[model samples]
Target: MKANQKATILLIYTGGTIGMIKDADTGALKAFNFKKLIKGIPELKLLDCNIETVSFEKPIDSSNMQISDWQKTAEIIEKNYTNFDGFVVLHGSDTMSYSASALSFMFENLNKPIVFTGSQLPIGDLRTDAKENLITAIQIASLQEKGKPVIQEVSLYFEYKLYRGNRTTKISAEHFNAFTSPNFPELVESGVHLNVNNEVLLKENVSKKLKVNTNFDDNVFILKLFPGINKTILHTLLHTPNLKGVVLETYGSGNAPMENWFIDEIESAIKRGIHIINVTQCSGGTVLMGAYETSTRLKEIGLISGKNITTEAAITKLMYLLGQNVANSVFKTIFETSLRGEMND
Candidate 1:
């Protein structure tokens, strides 16, 4: 691969709806060969970008995606970092947000575009949108202006919109546009023309080098606070054996009951060195933990506010940081900061 070539794009097929095909005889979903992608979509020739694909030995749904899968994606990028101008990840919708969010954090100081795209329908079917999505994703990946990458961060390009991966969430199950990022603004809106929200996009460190950290420790749990919950239940959750982190979904603005049992359990978790991340249950607003009296007790403890970070981003960031074996103190401080443009910094 020549560095001076117009552009080189790497397509990483991690398995998902885009690769699904219904057998003519049995009508069952099966992974189809991506080699036929260009054959089916002849329009790819207009892209004018050098593209190559790498797929898993046996494609699995995103629900089956594991730490090993993330490790594989990171390895691909690492091996071809200098050879490719950008990357596009084909993933299933079920866990697309989670995986994209995790990659946003795992890849630090990224200079090239890492755009994740997949279709709601299979590529082989008639009236399928896979060709358009995949083709446009490649265009977005190789897009440039003034000899600099147009997008220099990890993002999700779906249904003509590009969003910061960590800020995005899968909000729709039946529509082609299945993702939403209400807290942060969309980076690119593809309508009559590709409209990019340049201010919201992240800038790369021209001097710093690319860094990839594939280690992801998923030893975490989520506890949603609801009314009529018993004290024993709260204790059981906070005292879970071998707990490393927790994503605590609280009421509006991260407010939670100041009841003695609730406060005690959270405090105990903090004392035990468990990283407790407080995020608002509402999809739009941030977690202002100390903004209300009801949440003062939680702030009195060491529970950290996730701010405008989405639940998907929170869990993935926790997994990535924990896997890095970072110091407890550093993890506590960095969790609230935007490391890879995953949160509003």
Candidate 2:
């Protein structure tokens, strides 16, 4: 990222709708051969940066995205960290938020742009939005100022907006604007010009080397509470073998049913060394643990408050923290803390 030096961008394609095209023989959708990617989109030659392409040996639908895939993605970035100026990750939109959030936690002290983007329609379709999304994502990743990358954290760009990857949630299935960052503001927006909200971006850190942590423990579950959530269901989830963490999707303001059994069950789980984090079911608000009488018991019984964190981020953060084997005494404090700008202060 030196002045007058052209940026080099690594495009990591991990499979998604954006990489699909209709097979000539059967007309069925299939992954586009990335080796021919440039041939298909010669427009890439027009960019000011040098672009290199890499693909997952076997591309997977985002619904099938797993912990191992996340590790692989992180490893890819780790392997090329020194050689590349920026990275653009092509991921399926279905579980893009989870993968993005996981990568944000996996890489500590990240100092380059890792822009994740995918299209709602296949690139072959005449009405596809894939071209614009891919084009703008690379543009954002290539942005530089004072001989340094402008974006230094993981982010998601869809439709026309760029958001902190961990702060995003897929909000629509049919529309082009499929993701939203409810609690945090967008980092960049695309239109007639690419407008970067510089103040909202994560400040760059140059002193520390990029550290990749792939030890994600999947011994966690999200227990979304609802009316008539019986004791049997609660017991089953709480007593699951090797259950290290639980992202409890509680009622408004992190409230739960004010019954003796509910309190006893939650307290028992906490005593058994189970980490339960209370996140609001609502999409756009912080969890106020002691704002109501019903939530007062949870706050007193040692549940961590996930202030305004999306469920996708909460679950992945739980896995990342658990895998770190953080001390039991400090688990609550650490869970509540804003790591990688996933939550507000």
Candidate 3:
């Protein structure tokens, strides 16, 4: 890694406040040409990297982000993976976490940075935080250690902090500091000097070639449990046509009512080959099934524990695993285990 060498970074604009500008007459925010972005922020030219920009023909808002978009994004990465040292994804703040999480699982044996970032206010706004986020994201992606990419996994960078992508959630709408990885620690912190927590970063396996999985089965749904939830509603949802999996957002420690009807519905669903995963509704914590009598039946009934996994990650993991056609016999075991460093053991 010669100091004179420059990392070649690819900036993929997928539509977000970071790439938005105010319409002169309409006064509404609209997507701008990412190719001309570096001109507005000349600071990007000063970075120790060679940057190239690409944009979605019709950039979509992150809220409108779907499986198809994930597949396209992955395809772009796969096609250009060899030519670029790292990738910076510009996505809307709203659903950035979900996209990031999905991409993490999509790229198997990834050995380069896939950094997602966005701003709360439009980049053209006077008070915007877009420039800092965008600049830092690129810098983080282009980082190298001993001539190799340092951040070799999907991640989200906002407010000067770099987080494991799947672990982040949009915690604020108006504030510049919008995303938070509640259950995970910051991978890097940017202050006067960029700080990389090398110990916590994902270890790269350079020996394996990158493999992309774009087959995402959308035959999944999330069921957030609540007090006095009617069995009829639960039954209806669990019986959704072609339903393959469900991310059950349960109470503390994955507990639920011990009523016979509730337990019966769960068992019935499981028996029918519908995967049920128990994830905590709390912002931060692991699901400790069977810790209480209320949760004992859930564990006994074979609900997979989503230990410290965010809802975004849980739902996407369910979709990814189902898409992979994991054997029904080993699905439970695999679901409980952390894939792509997405959850705690």
Candidate 4:
């Protein structure tokens, strides 16, 4: 690598469909050495970038993903904070949103690309989509103009679409287009030409230094309001011992039942200093806590609106923000506000 060379990209493979291969001995799927990745994709040599791989010591299935794994990914990024211009995470699609959302909140004031990508099929298959997904992700991570990153936010690149990581949710199991941003537009779409919707991107904090937050409070719960829900179960969840925060899934426009017991329970939780975030159950709308009389009680009881955020984003954002030991009064304000380009301003 010369002093005046192209941008460097760090490809972090944290276990996913993209790295799987047929083990000759066992005939079982296993993750292969990333050193052989280029041999399978010769087109990578045509790109004007220096790409490097950093695979996990022990590849984990998406089902085995843990909070500790998130910490490991963060530490890696922190260690290479200045060496690489951007990062591409080849991850299991099952938990990609959670990982992406966590990273979005963890890396405050970040100005580099962190694109997460995975395929529906294993790379060893003849018709595997992994090669296209991985190749383009590398290209996107290395994208720059005027000597600055064109994509300065965490994103998910899959099935020819690039979405804001924190704002997306997986909505399919068998389809190549598995994820979507319920309320936001696609950030970038891959085609004959890569068209970037710059207007939808999060503006980088040009004045603030990059701040990485490692601490995360995992003492959080989610309760989706539905008809016929038992009040006992509801109280148990809200009244859990030493609960810190909650992500409440409410009806359209943040409407909840006006039942006296429900209202009273919410009020009591607020009195106990538990942050209650009211997010809509619907995929594509913002929660308006006071829009209707039905939701007035929620607002009066101090429920916060999670405007246009997916369930995956809400839970992780709450964990990230709550871990910072911020005051209770601040949690409501911060949860509803757009952080890490997760929601609209």
lDDT of 2 at 215: 98
Candidate scoring better on lDDT of 1 and 3 = 3
Against the true structure, candidate 2 reaches a TM-score of 0.99
Model 2 C-alpha lDDT per residue in residues 1-345, reported as the tens digit of each score: 678999999999999999999887898999999888778888888989999999999999999999999999999999999999999999999999999999999989999999999999998888999998998899899999999999999999999999999999999989999999999999998989989999989975689877899999999999899999998789888999999899999998899999989899999999999999999999899999889999999999999999999999999999999999899999989988988999987
- Candidate 1 lDDT over 169-287, as tens digits, reads 99888888899998888888877777888887889777988788888877898888898888888788777888899999999999998789778888988889899999988978888
RMSDs, each prediction? 1.7, 0.8, 1.0, 1.8
lDDT of 3 by residue, 131-171 (tens): 99999999999999888898999999999999999998888
> Model 4, range 88-147, lDDT digits (tens) per residue?
998999999998999899988889999999988888777888988988888888888777
Q: Tell me how far the alpha carbon of residue 284 in candidate 1 is from the true structure, in angstroms, after superposition.
A: 1.0
- TM-scores for all predictions: 0.95, 0.99, 0.98, 0.96
Q: Model 3 segments beyond 4 Å from truth?
A: 1-3
Residue 263 lDDT (model 1) = 87
What residue pairs are clashing in model 4?
none
Task: List runs of model 2 lying over 4 Å from the truth.
Answer: none
| Between candidates 1 and 2, the TM-score winner | 2
User: Positional deviation of 281 in candidate 2, in angstroms?
Assistant: 0.9
The Cα local distance difference test for each model comes to 0.85, 0.93, 0.92, 0.87
Clash count list over all predictions: 0, 0, 0, 0
